[model samples]
Target: MLDERAAGVFTIAATPFLPDGALDLESVDTMVDFYVERGATGLTILGIMGEAGKLSSEESVAVIARVTARSDVPVIVGVSAPGLAAIRALSLAAMEKGAAGVMVAPPGNLRTDDQIASYFQNVADVLGDVPWVLQDFPLVTGVQITPKVLRRIFDACPTCKMLKHEDWPGLEKISALREQEAAGARKISILCGNGGQFLLEEVRRGADGAMTGFAYPEMMRDITALAHSDPDRARDIFDAYLPLIRYESQPGYGLAVRKYILAKRGAIAHPTARKPGPALSEAAIAEIETLIARQEARLSAL
Candidate 1:
C-alpha cells in the first residue's frame, strides 16, 4: 500500500496546441509551471482533457517528454487507446521518457470485466516496474471497472498504485477501496477525476485528492485548503464555485472553457484546440465570460 500522504491533487492537463494544431511545447511548459506553482502535487498529461485521443502516438510522446524534462514532480502520462500493443507501446514510451507513472483506460466500447483486467495486466507486464493509474472514465471509454475487477487487476499488478476514479458512482468506489485497505488487502489510492463538482464529497469519502480538468489551480487549491481546514467551509466555497464548474463541465465546451480560462489568465497563448472538435459556440463563450466575471467580482468583494 502506498502512503496516502504521497498522493495529492493531480491535474489532468490540457495540451496547448498551436493555431495550426501542432503541439505547443512552450505553452505546455507554462501550464506545467502554472499548476506546480499553485499546489498541484503531480501532472497527468495527454489525458482526456489533454485530448490524447486526438494526438498521434509520436505527438503524445513528445508532449510527455517535454513535461518530464521540465519538472521532477510526478508525471503520469495517459496511455489510452484501443489495441493492447498500442497501449503497451505508449505506456513503455512514457516510462522510458521518465514519467513517474502511466494512466490507462480499458478498450473503448468493450466493457467486459475480463477484457478490462487483461488490458491493464498486459500493459503492466510490458511496463515492468513502472507504476500505473487505472483511469476509470466510463463516459468516454464505455467500460466500467467494477470493484471485483479492480481487485483482480491490483492483485495481478502490484505496481498499479492508484485509480483516477471518474466513474459517477465514485464515492461508492472509494468506499470499497477503503474497505479493502482496512481489511489488510491490497491498497490503492483513489483520486477524484470528475472535475471539482464531486471533489468535496470525494475527499470527505476518503479520496487522496483530485485530478480535474479545470485550469484555474487557484480555485482547486483554495477548495483543497478549505477541505483540509474546515469541511463546512469547503462546502460553502464549493457552492460559490458551482457556477464556474457548470460552465466548464458543459458538453462540447469543457476543454474550450479550460483553454479560454487559461488564456484569460495568460497561462497559454490562445484557447485553441485541434480540429474536428469545434470551437465554443458564441453563447457558450459568453457563459464562460460571465462565470469569470462572477468569480472576479467575488474576489474583488473579498
Candidate 2:
C-alpha cells in the first residue's frame, strides 16, 4: 500500500486506445514496461491524463487489472467519481486488483471548506483502509483546496496518504504543508502535477516528486534524481526539455501532443485520442517535430 514515504517519479500513464477507439490491452503492457524501464519508480493510471473519464466502469476495472498485473512498481489508480458509492466501488475493485493505492479528486460542486473536508472525510469512510491520494488540481476541478482544509482531511483520515498537488502557483502550498508537518501535523507525500512545467521549482518547494504525464518520462526520471545532489545539472536537463514541455502544455490539446510523441517513441502504436478530442494539424505536427529536434540537440550538447 502507498504511504507518506512514497517519493520519486510516479508517471501519470496514458490509456492506450486502438484506432477504432477500443482499449488496447497489449499496449498497456508495453506502456508499463516503458515507464518502468525509464526509471519511473511508480505509475499512476486512469488519471485525467489517462483519459479515465472516457472509459466505462468495466473498462476502468479491466485497465486497472491489466496495469496492476503488469507493473512491478507501485500502481496508483485514479478512482475519482461524483458519489461516494461509485468511489467506493472503484476503490474496492482497484485494491482487489493489487493496486498500491487510489486517487480521488473533489467534485466541482464543492463550494466551502467544510464541504471539501466533509466530502473527503466521507471518501475516507467509504474507502475504508485503502490508501488514497487527494488530487488538488483546481484548474480542471474548479475547486480550490486550501492547505488548512487539506490538513483537516488528513487529520480526519489516516488512510489519505498522498496529495496530487496540481494547483497553479501551488509551491507555497507545498511549503505550508511541510511547515505544518514541522509543527507536528500529519505528513503525507506531495507529488506535483501540471505536466511537470514547474517540476524543478516544486521539488525545491519540498515536493516529493512528479505525478504528471509527459512524452519523455526519462526527463522526469533524470531530473528528480539530480534535483538535490546536483541542482545545477538538473536545471540544465530541465532547460533542454523546456520547449517541448511548453508545447505539450497547450490546453485542450496537450494529450494529443503527448500521445503523438509516445507513438513516435514506440511506447504506443498510435496517437489516437478518443471521440471529442482534437487531432493534431499538419502545422502542429511540424511544430512538435521542430521542438523535439531542438530538444535532442540541446540534450546532446548538455
Error of 2 at 178 (Å): 0.5
The CA lDDT of each predicted structure is 0.80, 0.93
Best by TM-score: 2
Cα RMSD (Å) between model 1 and the true structure? 2.1
What C-alpha RMSD separates each model from the true structure? 2.1, 0.7
Candidate 1 lands at a TM-score of 0.93
Instruction: Indicate the worst ten consecutive residues by lDDT in candidate 1.
Output: 1-10
Which lDDT tens digits does candidate 1 get at residues 157-256?
A: 9888888888886788888888887888777888877677888888777777788877666667777667767887777777767789877887676888
Model 2 clashing-pair count: 0
**Residue-wise C-alpha lDDT for candidate 2, range 25-77, written one tens digit per residue:** 99899989998999899999999989999999999999999999999999999
Candidate 2 has an lDDT of: 0.93
